[model samples]
Target: MAGRLLLIWRLLVRDLRRHRTETLLLLLAITAATATLTLGLTLHELVARPYEQTRAATAGPDLVVQAGQPGPHSLDALAPLTTLPGVTNHSGPYPLAFLALTAGDTTARVVVEGRDGTPAAVDRPAVTDGTWIRPGGVVVERTFADALGVHVGDTVSVAGHPLGVTGFAVTAARPAYPRAGWHLPGSILTEGGGLVWVERGDIATLAGEQPLSYTVNLRLADPQAGAAVIDPSGGDARFRGWRFSTGQEIADTNGRLNAPAQQALMIGSWLLTALAVVGVAGIVAGRAIGQRRRVGLLKAVGAGPAMIAAVHLAEYLVIALAAAGTGLAVGWLAAPPLFRPTAGLLGSVGMHPPPLRMVAAATALALTIAVAATLAPVLRAAATDTTHALADAAVPPRRRRWVISLSRRLPIALLIGVRINARRPRRAWLVTVNTLITTTALAAALMALAQERSPVDLGYSKLPDARDERTTQAMILVVCVVCFLALLNTVVSTWTAVLSTRHPLAVTRVLGATPAQAGVGLAVAQLLPAIPGVAAGLLLGILTFFAGDDNQHAPASWMLTAGLGVPLAVVALTAIPAVAAARRPVADTLQAGVR
Candidate 1:
């Protein structure tokens, strides 16, 4: 068995060396797939730690209770419940007041939790950049600090109070929400509204001297017991209740109150990974014909079909390992940054290395892609007889021959491109599938951009200052990336297609067609089948929105235009590469193809 394996390795290495291009592509693909998985899975554990720590420290409450209307006692009543079965220690029938703050023309609504005077309490927030809250000073969540461009000692006004910014900190308490990669939730902070720490006397007067409301934070005897308390409370606010969130949920949500961004990023990773797998599969199958002569030769020798297949498959496995390894590293590095844009939303101000599980999962995905893409062709090569495989060189009959015959009287360029493309329908199909995958990726990216639900200050939606800028940034990123990939794929596809079909194009030239005409003909062929593909992709995208949100199904004119324009753009973009490849010295290309 060892000797057989060695022999297969030798054969695979030799073939892999011969097909360096495909081997390189396999490496690139594995790297991409691995990177995406690692980033998606590990983001919370690695990148979201600061936010988690901040959330835990500030909230110190096991269940934060609130009142529907303003009354201080609704919070005080929770004291007896803590004395109930699972509960033990508790703090703060503390005042949590929400207020709208105005700093010059900029305004923000802030969620404020009254802090206990002591620094070392169980739910205490640790100071990060400056002194803790003094009688007249407040501490702001570090993430929010970074956003509001405020620091310790920088003063801002909230609800007409001139507050002293005494500190920047992370608390298990009040801070900005966490956001997924798809969006950012804008945040505003101050001394409890700039770090305005009012000695107890000023609290009610500053809060509009407003009607008072309060809530308590309890620390359970067993932290897990807190969840049991939370579940039963969901149905009614009559006991007027509290919902308990787990460490992980809190960590996840630490990035945002509603983690739409994280969910979007995860889905985006999965969707792109699927498209990459499909594209690679098409490319692998397209290369199978090119390997036929080699397959036949190996079979003709005493080598069994199994060894031949093993050799082909093993080549991919070797590359997959390297690619997966590389991709995992890239994912680890990228994950931290991916979360950077939304860090303020999470309330975290620290960075953590990704957990081991995220790296392992990503590597597995990369190998899966390589195996899934290459398995069929490798197996097919092994299953064939030597003579039959070797003798499989009969001229591929012209596809849709009758149709081409009928169109022969048409313009030279269209006739030639159609005839050649028809002869190798599978290659045309490979190109088409590649195009579709590109379209799918572009669409997913655009959707991510368009659907961003980043957080903003509550009730500030109608405010002049509130802007969903992240969504705009995401849109520009998606468009730029899609355009670049579209241009890149168009050129490469045309060049590869033209090179693969050069013999036919050369023959057309021999039969009396201009080189320019032949080149244009190649573009025509790609454009024809691509029409339906682009249209279908557009319809799918539009339907996706409708399916995802029945209300969003309103007819969109731009989608239709983009869908129609993609194929036309593909054809136009392809012309330069096709023309360049076509103008290559015909005799030289024919000689190369012959060899």
Candidate 2:
């Protein structure tokens, strides 16, 4: 038993050292998969935990009532809500007015709130920087301040009235900016703006009797029952164009601010995971074919099938373990950049370690992909007959009259490549799958980026929906990484193919096939499979993205271009490696072919 274990260990170490580049590529593929999965699985917890903490710290309101009327006493309409059932406490009838804020080169539409110098009982704004609203100063909302790059002591023109920035504050009375305005169900607001606070004494200076809306933050005994009690009529039956927001809804809004980005992360992660599996599988298959002689040698030395298989599998297991660790660390670091601090809280939230279940799941997936792809090839290689293994020979080709007849009609180089592919159809399929995964991810990303409307395009400088733009950016990131890795896989797979076909290619070269022709033949083999793969990937991308999207718009023509371009790019990428292999000394290759 000890001797068998020692042999396996020696084989494992030797193989790993001999194939350092292949091992590195394998690690990167697995790392990408696990890192993306970790981010996708834990996004909810990352976004929600900090929001809940912020909500608790700010004493966020249970219900927010917006009363709009064309009069100075518009707040009087909401006075009746103070007497409503389940309304345990109330904060305001604070003045709400819309105005333009100009800060240097930037101009933004802002909703200004009038508050007293004293803090409220229901919804308290947590001041992150500077001081609260002073007599002649304005407190900018955190998100708004961040967007405008304005800090304390800077003067901002609010409704054309210049005021010194006193501090940055965040409130739970509404979901941050852009969404600060009331959005009717199924009806997006034509315009959205951010929020700011000023002392009651300064309200008249900016508002000037422009018929402000009055908002009251209410604390309820049963916060969840807000919709039932607050909006009984479900229409303007309560107040003219009035809206009500429940506490739980506000919490959800804050927590799901990055819903679009999180969605992209999840979708991209799954696609990348599938690609990772294909890449590792291809590498394993290629490695197994290349190492047939090694397998035969082990068998001749009296090593059992179990010991040979263990040696091959152990190499991947170590790489898988290392990949998982690298991925976890990357995911942890990557998550922080996705979530930026908003006005509601002063400090950035520290990244809490993901739950044990998430780490376990990610690690298990990485291992499964590594082990599963190689298992079949390992078993097959281990079971090889000693005679064939020692001779380093393939099984006799089945005689096909049609193949011989067809070869005469094709160019010599293409004929040679076609014959090679016919011998190893499974390898061709693996390459096809790799291109398919890459194209599909690229298509999805292009579609996502196209659908996203930037905040500036919508005529708002600082809206809460800015998170949606961030989501699109994340999708682009995923696309770039997936495509890059796919390119690397192409290079590696080509190199492996060259190694496998050296002797056959050399014979063709000796028989008068030019190096360029040999290179074209090799590239054609990859291209033949790519045609079907590209088409399938396009369809797959369309179905995946459209099925998940609420909008049913047809994909643009450019998307097709991007999808079809991937396979072409892969064919082109194989050229250098193929040419390099073709130009290798024919005499040496033919000599090496002999057992």
Candidate 3:
């Protein structure tokens, strides 16, 4: 058994070294799929890490209670909760003043909270730059400050009063910037804005006649008991006009913001995996045709079918494993940036080893794509009779009276292209599927772009909703990758067709067909199947992504462009390889075919 294993290993190494380009193509196909799969599976965890760090560093409260309506007595209404059951520690019924803030040329609605000069026991904002809030100075939430381009020493007008920026800080008491506005009393539907802090003494003066809301941060004996602690059903009148949020709830909210990006990635990963299957299947099929003689030689030397199959599969299995590892590393390193922490959170998320489950899933996908694509072709090659394989005779092309009659009146290029496609119908279909996947992905990206109405209003300037921006980005990435893989598949299929038909094409050349005709025939073969593919792809893209959302349909002009453009691109991609193969010296090709 050990000797047999060694023999098989040697055979695999020699084969891989001999066919370096094919091996590299297989690796590229599987690695692309696995990397995208890894990103889809692990992005949520990656995005959550920074928020967790922020929560821990700030000693974030288990529950935050906010008054529903701003009034002088809001603090009194919230005071009773400080000593409530299960409360271990508490931070003030801090005064919250909703006001417009203007810094530089930007103006935004902000929730200005009044904080003591000293840090509280719970929900303390960690100063990242400069000092904490002082008597006439204000501190801006780190993300908010970054958005406003305000640093320490800059003055921001709050409700028409100018106060010098004292510091920039982050806190877990509120969801990150743009989301913090959700906590405002009586403003649950308000668009996300920013948060800032001022000395407690400055609140009354800055607010003037504006009613003030209050919030209390509580540390519960059981952090998870927050929901239970807050009376629901309005059974207690004291709980009326108030809202309660648990730390877990806050974390979930922040995490939910990444759902769009995650959805795009997950969907794109599957699309890419499908393309990998199609691309690898074509490569394997072509390689099988080229390897018949080798299979015959092994059989003549007494190699059994199982040994033959194992030798073939081992090469791909090794490549697949290597691809999986490469993909996992790339996915891990790439994820943090795609689902990066919003500026609102403290600490940065860096690349870390993916979880075991994610690694397993990615590896499984790569191996599955390899096995599924290669198995049938390899098995067929293994089962061929030794004499037939050794002879390496090409199968005779099937003739039909209707096909001959139809081609008689057609142009030389179209006639040859039709016959060529008829000879290798399976490769033609793979090319079709390749075009379909690319078109579908491109259409989906266009739909995503068309659906955006406007950026979220962030006071001073509009910013794209993080979710929309990330989703669009993910879609664009998927489209680009799918297009790249499709282009590769086109080139491979066209070249393989060119090689398979060289003898017949050379005969046609001798019969007065020009090299350009032969080349255009090859391109035409790919384009014939692509017409239906592009149409199906447009329909699929619409059904999959725009079915329920009437507003998400891409403009008719864009759809028309994609429909016409893809086949043209297919023609362009196939032309290079087709022309190169067609222009090969006919005399040489014919002699090789005869030998």
The model with the greatest lDDT is: 3
Rank all candidate structures by their TM-score, best first, as comma-separated numbers: 3, 2, 1
Off by over 4 Å in 3: 68-77, 182-191, 230-234, 457-463
Global lDDT of each model?
A: 0.58, 0.76, 0.83
Give the TM-score of each candidate. Answer: 0.79, 0.82, 0.92
Tens-place lDDT digits, model 3, residues 392-490 = 888788888888899889999999888987878888899888888888888878877888557668655676676776677778877887888787777
Cα lDDT, model 2, residue 143: 78
Q: Clashes per prediction?
A: 32, 1, 3
Candidate 2 local distance difference test against the native: 0.76
Compared with the true structure, model 1 gives a TM-score of 0.79
Q: What is the alpha-carbon lDDT for the whole of candidate 3?
A: 0.83
Worst 10 residues of 3 by lDDT: 181-190
Candidate 3: residue 343 Cα off by (Å):
2.3
Task: Quote the RMSD, in angstroms, for model 3.
Answer: 2.6
